[model samples]
Target chain A: MKIHIYQIAITLISSLMIFKGFENYIKGKNGQTVLKLLVRIIVWGGMVLIALFPRFTNILASTIGMEGNINAIILTGFILVFLMIFKLLSAIERLEQSLSQVTRNETLKEIKKED
Target chain B: MTYFENSKIFIVIPAFNEETVIQGVIKEVQSAGYENIVVIDDGSSDNTQAKAAELIGKMAFRHKINRGKGGATKTGIEAAKLLGADIIVTIDGDGQHDPKDIAKIIAPILEKKCGVVLGTRLLNPKGMPLWKIFANHFGNFCTWFLFGLWVTDSQSGFRAYSKHAAELINTRADRYEYDSEVIREIHLHKLKFKEIPVAVRYTKYSMGKIHKQGFINGFKTLYKMIWGLIS
Candidate 1:
């Protein structure tokens, strides 16, 4: 099978979308945003690596980072999109956690009988 | 003529994450002589199923994930109808509705005064939050405007449906909007339903866990109701 640049680009985009969605789903389940910066740092580091050394495609593929010269560029784009989704999901998780916590505290306080 | 006698009147309580009140609601409802009461636990992470099971009822159901009140309701109705309930009475599992009022909601249908009965809390909205008051009024007015008929309360969840009415309004929304959608169906199908005065007891606990997004979701509900009306 010829490793066509376009096919590799499409696969990279699709894989990035799946990974990004999976991250959001996990964050959503945990209902927390404390790791958003950590996620951004990792994502940015990966982007920097790809931007600086575009020829490192084969090495990236072996390292499970990325594959193909054209695939690397598409993946870089995909990673940027995923980062935005990660931020959004993390923000939502934080909001949900705070709201649920407030509601929980209120419920506990309401349970106390007034003298 | 007595379906409750020959066949059981399965009271279907559609609950959504109701761990806090399911047990109490189940206990109250179980005290009544009606056999074959089925409770649909709509994907509650809490002890809704366990609490309901402890109430000594015949059967209990649960959804793997939250599908809203409409999903739970459809589950209950389908189960009861499939279980051969002569009549199915849908009441909230939120504990705001009085189990004692169950008889009143179902009586009119049994006696054939109306094909369906909706327990209108028009007189007892005192403890209800202000937003709900406004939303319900808006709903009532919209329903009246569209149907060109008078309905005291359009968003009351405490209601009764004959097997026939149940069969007619088989489709239901998968959200808190079921109440209004059902009313729209009742109007469109030309099915007769009576709005009777029933006392509603609202407490701080119950009020805390109600549909708080009143007017914010009012237009959405209006849209759904109208959609149901047109379709």
Candidate 2:
């Protein structure tokens, strides 16, 4: 029932992340789909809610058959790591495709010049 | 029964930032009596294209941007195919490769001894750097381990391929790894491969041009070979 400095800090950080994720979706910078955007917003929003209300995490932890209140934070941490790795892999795939395209285009240009 | 001298042979020199030495290499090849020459300038910022321009009859290709050595070599192969080449020989743009050695490497292909002729420098490693020799051995070992193909030098840039082999040994690697990829292709396609001892001139510039990741590149190439096979 006590709001601490760490809770306030976590809430602010998660809010910023949510705002940036939405901003990127709106600006079309990341080429995220509507579904993907909603998922990101919901995920970060859930983090913000959990940060603001620590007792809610205790309920989630117990429901998930986890022992301690800290287990919720551990679960969130694992989810964040998995999401980051997924994002990195997709980004690398995109980069590889673009690089191959660039190389093919350049090769075609040279061939055209020869003619 | 077709001799290389009578066939339509196309020499593809893949050059990247070799503006200083490309002209001399081309002239040397011309002097060796090889009429068909194509230079694929892999988007050099210098006057490599301009210097090659003086050769009126030969073709010079310039990539719009810097594609890697593999891309340039692929472009050169395409140009050769367009010219209806019977034999395609690829040589480095740097003067490290001897233009005269083209005949020696192509001789096997002409004699029907092999479809792919690799010009190896390890036999007479007189002027070759010690690091390069080690690198070549390491590359050969990786090629053996990955593809069960063994050669004296798997990383040699100077090679001759029959038109069929050249067309068949396609690769997607856009860097120095293409050298290793070619060996994998040769093996996968079940082409007859031969190795010939050839001399190489290792100038300070050419030596410096060797990818510093020669050792690491072997592993990368092996990974690519496996990925390519499965995917």
Candidate 3:
């Protein structure tokens, strides 16, 4: 029945993020796809649940056949971080290619103007 | 000389921040009987564009942002193609490549011996730094491993492309890996390519340029080549 300071902090942060995600979805910012919005909601909602009820992680760990809840949480956090990093890298590479193409086309267009 | 008179040879010099030597490099290419010079200033913060523009007959195109050497070279190639270039020769803007050898590299293309002529410095690497020689060989090995085609100097920027070859070899790399990509294009398209010995001038100024590919860049180029293959 004891509520720790860390638990309150995490719940507050996750709730704020969840509210912001829904607000953006309502405002149609970044062309928010349904699947993207669903994923964001699931991730933030899961964090809020875990912060509010630390015992939920024990159930998750048992379902995943893990001995300890801390190990399960750490492993899932690492996987999520790595997936986000990979996605960001790929996106950056795509943006770089687009920028190069635009610059190249503009330079070539100047030749046509001169002729 | 008569062959050059018949062909519209465009000398493409892809430069980035080479303000001190752009004019000299332009003059050298001009003195070597190549009047159609296209200098692609790859978003240089210095006076490279202004210096190149000072030369009346040469064409200077500026990129709104820096896109590395490969991007600049590709832009230059595209511009040269639009300008009706029959034979396009790409040279470094740092004056490291001798404009005198332009005739030698383009001879094979002019004679219809090959669609692409690669100027190899390894054939006669006199006055070339020892470390550069080693790095070039490593680059050649990496190119062979990644693309399954090998040349003496896969990293050499001094090259000549016939109109047909230039039109066919469309590369996607926007960095140093572009040279290796050209080799891959040659392999994939079955374009006839000839490698000939060409002279390289390594001066204090060229050696001092920060943009030159060093130990770290070589690995980065290799990584990009592999990533291109996978993605």
Candidate 4:
């Protein structure tokens, strides 16, 4: 069994990311939702698994009907990036709406106080 | 005496960093025979609130944070509702709208002709710039396409709403798109609306304001309106 240096580096980075995700959840920062934490953990866990088992990439590529492992990885990366972008955009829109509502309610409350 | 003389007309001025023109706008509205003025200062870093507050008989409410013009206008509407307003007239704090037109805008509502009355500058766009005329037409077209409601000046901030219309037309947009959203609300609620030709004052100061409607904001507003429909 030959272990590549790149595999070691990838596993190390992925492990650190997984740990950080848990740490953030524990700290209750960013209003982290359970579903968000689960998604983060699953993504990082999959990265760690792929780095530890290089042969799994071949299986994944074959299962996905891709010609090569690199192609499979690139496609998956693009999908993940786009999905994350969409999720972030939705979150931003929700936050903006909430902020506007809060500002409006506060302004109205002050007016009520004056009256 | 005018038809709306007996009605409690609340002039809602949604201001954002308009310290330079807040007081003058309030005075103009005051001189226009409207005393129940509600100035919603949308979290201006300047002295817009103080200037508006200095004017007697004007109720000034400041948002702790900058909520776009739509948000401020919504707050003004809600405050006016609480203050027992029979008719609410929203005017830009930048002083672009003629305060004298307040009477004309609210007449349709007082006459029971419509639930909502919009002041259109396109009919009498005398001093309006060529670019503004084009932009307003584009906005009107977009509002028609998106909201299925068309008016001469869909982007006009100077509008008068009867208490029923004001309470019924709840908007979700917090920016320029809110103007279009009001059109959607009018269509959805089947509220009778009238567009009256109103004079617009295009001054160097108003045109110079970076926050006023422009090319980029127009596209952003269009995108937001689409997004709102989808989401």
Candidate 5:
């Protein structure tokens, strides 16, 4: 089935948002503090509804672009994109830890002096 | 009452089944000379309530079971506010946080600089577990990128908040996410925040103690950051 650019984007973004939101909720993510777990659950539920309702997805697709096999493409993209983000986070964490050690040493020295 | 001779600072110690750890925490805070300390029980089944029973005039609130860390911390702040505390500082019941850092943590707020003080452990992620270092930096980067503000560490549980910031952050997430989610609101509200370099002992005892599905949950933290970015 051919799809529209808008539909493709809407479907992809919504799906990505839902997936990431659910992932955070399941993994005990932090932003859930504002609405509690309700917001994450609602986002996950919405994703399920979108996947089930082709018309809803098609409407979103219509806004994105004229397309074909957009859902499959989006699903693939979501997985790859998340993996890439994961890698990016890992690299950044490694670098930050390396930089903070000196400050941490000074912090310990100050704590001891206070004693 | 401006950090003068007779100033009062109430501490909110959130204890979750902390029979072993609560004692030292109370003693530690007392040693720091913070008089108006309050411990919120958060419905612990153990001797948590009993251990903290010695302090006179200290308000204690207990949840039936567990309302989560965020709920417990909120209860402490609200109770401290009611008790007329000039500043409220949060100390972890578990021995993971170094109590000596309290003064540094609260200095800015005591001086009326920043509304909130976050005890950041970002200065030395190298000596820690690889997984934790990875997780924390990713979360910190997302916070900095999205909010356009810099906080060296976002995941540390130890923190100090001015009475104003305490009240502002009283309504935090009901779980660990409360730590990150509060950062969002702090920015949204345009409240000033500072990250004080604090020491943390990351022993196996202090690990996140994830349940049966630990890996899956860590993945969810990553997903949460991505969702924050996309949204």
Candidate 6:
């Protein structure tokens, strides 16, 4: 029942993150901000719980039918990275769309000048 | 007989670093009696824009940055539409495509046989490189797989489009994959497509360009096609 120094530090940091998330959520003016803040709090809270009670990961692994906690963590991490990549790709797609628009507009202007 | 004399046909030449060939292509298109010609310079570092600019009173649009061939083609098409073009024929700025074929390709669309006229190089692949023939067949296979239609040459850049077909074909591919994407768009929009046998001359320069495009570009286009379909 002895809590490690590292666990205490991680918990404190996670609590601070959760507090910041809540503050942002309360001050958020849009649905996107609120959703982002909520996700941040949940992720930080999960980190804190995992840091304090690492054995919970074993239970999660068992529930998920994984061989070990490491496997479960790896799978979750993979999914998080995958989702992040998809989000980044969507942003890139938007940028590409705007770039194309600008390119089209500029070309149109040039054509007008010639005409 | 002047087939397209009454029709407003715009020849859209999309050029990228084709400083050596752009002027010739423009002159050839003009000499063929097609007055409505637009050369879209796709932001080449070299003198592509300058070469295109040499032709006085020609409609040329210059992109500020390199937006790929697809982006350039789209820009050229937009210019053609602005000029009140009834038929848009997209040809590469490279001198490989015969400007005379513009009339031949548009004939099907003019006759109301198809909404789009695709120039197929497979009919007479005489001087084309071996790699291009292979890449073209591979592209044809992909088109069949994606659209369930067997086309002779799906990746040929020389194609003719009616105003209806050109406006309806919406594609997001900004690179070499745009050719394949155009085929997919034609199928998705249910536009009637006709493939005509056209001759392509493969110079040492064009052969190098084709070899450079090679398999890597083909694979990239396939990946983009899949991405376009799902996303």
Q: Who wins the lDDT comparison?
A: 3
lDDT of 4 by residue, A1-115 (tens): 7888988888888789788888998899976778878987788787777778867888999998988899877876887797678778778888998999888787777557777
Per-candidate DockQ values are 0.02, 0.18, 0.49, 0.47, 0.03, 0.44
- Cα error, residue A61 of model 2, in Å, equals 16
Tens digit per residue, CA lDDT, model 3, B8-88: 999999999999999999999989998999999999999898999999444798998999999999999999999999999
Indicate the residue-level lDDT of B65 in model 5.
51
CA-lDDT, candidates in order: 0.69, 0.81, 0.90, 0.89, 0.66, 0.82
Highest-scoring model, TM-score? 6
Query: Can you tell me the CAPRI class of model 6?
Result: acceptable
In model 2, which regions exceed 4 Å deviation?
Answer: A1-115, B56-58, B210-231
TM-score of chain B of each: 0.88, 0.91, 0.97, 0.97, 0.84, 0.94
lDDT of 5 by residue, A1-115 (tens): 6665765666677767766766777787543554534554455455555555556656656666645547744863595577558647755644433333332233234223444
Per-residue CA lDDT of model 5 for B79-192, tens digit only, reads: 666666777788777767777788888788878899888888778554567776777787778667755665777767777777677666633244455567678778877899
Per-residue C-alpha lDDT of model 1 across residues B1-231, encoded as one tens digit per residue = 555577558788877677888888877877866666778777677888878887744467766666567667766777777677777888888887888888888888888777888888875776676767777787789877775656787777788888888889844465556776677688779899888777787777666764533565678767755654543
Candidate 5 lDDT (Cα, 0 to 1): 0.66
Runs off by more than 4 Å, candidate 5: A1-115, B1-4, B55-58, B124-127, B145-148, B170-172, B208-215, B220-231
lDDT of 6 by residue, A51-90 (tens): 8888888998999888889997787678668757865776
* CAPRI grade, predicted model 4: acceptable
Residue A100, model 3: lDDT of: 99
Candidate number with the higher TM-score (3 or 6): 6
Error of 3 at B137 (Å): 0.9
Candidate 6, residue B206: the lDDT equals 67
Q: Going through the candidates in order, what is the number of backbone clashes in each?
A: 0, 0, 0, 0, 22, 0
- Candidate 4, after superposition: displacement of residue B103 in Å? 1.2
lDDT of 6 by residue, B1-231 (tens): 555566799889888888888888889988988878888888887888877877835476788998888888988888898788889999988788898888789999889899999999999898887877988898899878986767898888999999999889987878887888888888888899998888897777766664235677778878877766655
Model 4 chain A poorest ten-residue lDDT run? A106-115
Q: What residue runs in model 6 are displaced by over 4 Å at the alpha carbon?
A: A1-60, A110-115, B1-3, B56-58, B210-212
